[model samples]
Target chain A: MKPTTLRSFLPRPAINQRICISRVSRGYAVQAPGNPTLQVFNRNTKYLQKERAASNVERSRQADYLKDEVAMRLSERLLDINRHFNHVLDLGANSCNIARALTLPDPDIDPSKTTSPPLSTRISHLTAADSSRTLLYRDVDLPFNQEINLTRQVLDDEERLPFEAETFDAVLSSLSMHWINDLPSQLAQINHVLKPDSPFIAAMFGGDTLYELRTSLQLSDQERRGGVATHVSPLADVRDMGGLLQKAGFKMLTVDVDDIIVDFPDTFSLMRDLQAMGESNAVLGREPGGIQKDVLLANEGIYRELHGNEDGTLPATFRMIYMIGWKEGPNQAKPLPRGSGQINIKDILGGGEVK
Target chain B: MPTRISPIEKFAKAAAKCSVESSAYGKCIVVDYNSVHKDKCLTEFLRLKNCYLAAAKKP
Candidate 1:
């Protein structure tokens, strides 16, 4: 967090911006022939589509509290920037939760605590894009007129955004980036479409997400089958995301973590909730044939014993990593050139003399 | 213009270069198919990758 670190860590805006442009001159170079090694996420679009379909069905039956929470929180953070966006794109806009949050503030929800202006006032147009065809058509039931503000809902994959360069003024993604197979390259795609100095804010589950469930499942599999299988998809660590943003040619970057712990009656209900949320284990390396009955039961016991609360409910932790990065531009802040500091750190710390 | 490959395909291609004979565990890449499920995971991964490519081709 030191100034020196920031200077070294962040790419110089003006120079790096041009460099980024040249590097991505041809747009996303995803499939070079004979490369043979670019499988980042499971990239199982069938499973991904199925998961989104199931979540869409669940959304009709019950509200998605987690998605709504993330959307609202992201909205709050976007407003904190105090910049009005003429056009904003919501990537992986599952059911347009973030779009709704941006377009309309709930009437029933308390507004007394909200001091800043509503996001709707600032954004002239909003586009919600998602890979799930169902989510693209799903009813968000927004209070605002969709035609006026929520301009477009497109069904598209995040990995390859079909947009011209420097299109949007701002971009927001919630709880979706983690599923991307190649996040860095995809982030570069994001960087490509954004206008210079525009902000891109995203939130995804961190490495610590579902730690309790993962540990219990591992213990159960080990005790019952004498080996552990992949029950949870690997999550991105917060520490790693900062470097990714920088690598993607972003400036003035920030990454932080937020933890949400929900209590369930039992492991069964926890698993059900995960399914309903479209967050089931879809790792390609996962043990095939699914969890056996014995292992599942054992996992329940272990989960209850280890993470259960006094109220007979078990804890499920979700660590969300939030990141904000600005597309490099001349307007963005840049660190002073090295050896330009007037005050020496040693002088302040009462250390050695000037060299 | 050069043909633009999908990000997943690019990652899959990069993964092929790594012949560690075990899971490639990292922040960006985590392929446990070679380690745990062996050929099953790898086969399925290839099939899925092809599906992604085919799907990407349509419109």
Candidate 2:
């Protein structure tokens, strides 16, 4: 008797139909034309910056502090939902931070014992997508990587995602959406790719991020050069995010803000760290010649005078906006129609007897 | 009604007006990127920035 395979058991017409279906599904990954008016960031420059930062292993490691912290916070938020995601997409994933956070045992838990539930129990498989190839492969050889199913894909967040509709069980992003030029379109795409009622959790820098640095730089420029240049990139306001998510067709929206204040010895150290983190300004039409030394010196003094701690360290504020929205689905909970309630407000409050 | 141009196009047009200064500044920054100092490309930067600002102000 001849050895038989599962594919061989299928009829020839069935195989041809499967191939045709796959081809049609693959063609659904279309790239939408982005609006040019909203192009505030130079994505090419941002990519080059990320590549350059990732070239130095030591510096990049030092710079991973912010991303790591944000990733941990995002993972904690994911765990709160108590839903197990079979397949998740980590959009704009930097070095698989979310994957690492999920797989690695909690610091407070004992490693040998299984008393506390593992965080990775929440996610079965994660697809970590990022624009920078170097950043994506930075931690490929980590030991914890073996514990989870993680796949890395080099993807530009500025462009339309190359995924089929309703492909992801859930989508999570950390400290990446702020760099995007068209956030509404991105959010809609994210919603489109998520399974029904699946959560889309994300964190982005808010408008108040680095305000101290922004003001100091402006003051320095005005005093020295008689005019101020756009030094800091603009960020999304927390107030606008909920509206954007609602407009994107997500239901049960939750938006909150957090501030991470990091202390540095001086301005130069802070700037160096920002550069190493690939968070340097990528705004179009920005000053090509970097900040002038005299202006920087003046800004250092101004920064210290305005916002320096008593210990002499300069504090840089990073305001983060965390948002959670679920894709609309039929099985999800729905609010009752207005005036449909049976109970009276006065009766519920016990202020007056029911008529 | 006049056609409205995108911000990227407007910036691109302004940048084209100051290409010489922009190239000079770009070259300076790229050359000394690794060991760039505070005042490394002060002149080039200021010139390009001023030119671009002036160009951007025009209708």
Candidate 3:
């Protein structure tokens, strides 16, 4: 494969360049509310959390297992689609996990021989955008010999997308949408930005994610403090995903749920890992005080007692909801009209002749 | 049928009206983000939450 310069594929417009420069100089600002929109997660706090995680090189590296696993799984789904995307967008691309998954050769592939093409051969260019500048630039200098043309943009997922309509051939996100406040609107924005018939594939934390931790925290908090505060941010349910995508004007929707269980030595270790992963609770109006010492202790005991594994390891479930939707277009497949079939279903099923 | 407004959107709208309370609670948390415990800013948070609910009830 010949090396393609980023400039050769797409030229940067003067106006776009000026916008980028201005955005960089001003830093990211919260959306100026024209119409009243509800705020779910505090974007400023979330950005700070991600920035803190990115600053910790060691902890962040260890916490990347989850992102790496999810990224690979999402990429597999993308590869199943039999089309070459000329320009793809990786939305909420923290640490560029999707980019790494696409560009790097699989472990099974031999490095010496040029017999097999890299996975990224299907995409000619990738744009990685993240709300947190630090996380977006975390792996900027990583050496990938077969790297595809990539552009990094610091963008808040909550705000309106800066790109024009029907710009990207495909838009993919991994483990990001859960933090979005208005998910339906976000999905609509994604659908608007995709070229006709192009796919939007994403994986996010489902409602059942961290049930053990959530339950334990609630139980402990209720017992100790007489009331429970919002410790864990609410996530989207698998059942509602189809409706959301359809409401966003996406056709031919597919939603699947998967669970990844990770073993931690204790509850404290798990919580620390979550922080390192930039997955801390950012729910608005959440209890400001840290988890009380007594509550923490009680929560640990409750967590182990309720959900502990046999070998003394605590199991934490990360429920992932994967969804695929395509923008409507003339070239896409269409189902037949109602009652269009000529053959009777009874004959096919060998059930007797129709009266 | 008209689309029903989601509970999240309702809560968010209410929260938007209580920006002062919300920011006060948020500031308390940010001040001691790493070492925050239960009930550290309970008063501020509860005030914000109450304001949110109250605001949400109107219309």
Q: TM per model?
A: 0.70, 0.73, 0.73
* lDDT for position A226 in model 2: 67
Q: Report lDDT per candidate.
A: 0.70, 0.82, 0.81
Model 3 residue A161 lDDT score: 86
Question: After superposing candidate 2, which stretches have Cα over 4 Å from the reference?
Answer: A1-37, A106-114, A339-355, B1-59
DockQ score for candidate 2: 0.03
Least well predicted 10-residue stretch by lDDT in candidate 3 chain A? A293-302
lDDT per residue for candidate 3 within A28-49, as digits (tens), equals 7777866456688988889999
Worst 10 residues of 2 chain A by lDDT: A293-302
The collision pairs in model 3 are: A38-B12, A289-B36, A289-B37, A290-B36, A290-B37, A290-B38, A291-B37, A292-B38
Rank by lDDT, highest first: 2, 3, 1
Task: State the lDDT of candidate 2 residue by residue for A27-106, as single tens digits.
Answer: 65765775554789988899889889888878898989999999888888876686788999999887788888887665
- Calculate each model's fnat, 2 decimals: 0.00, 0.00, 0.00
lDDT of 1: 0.70
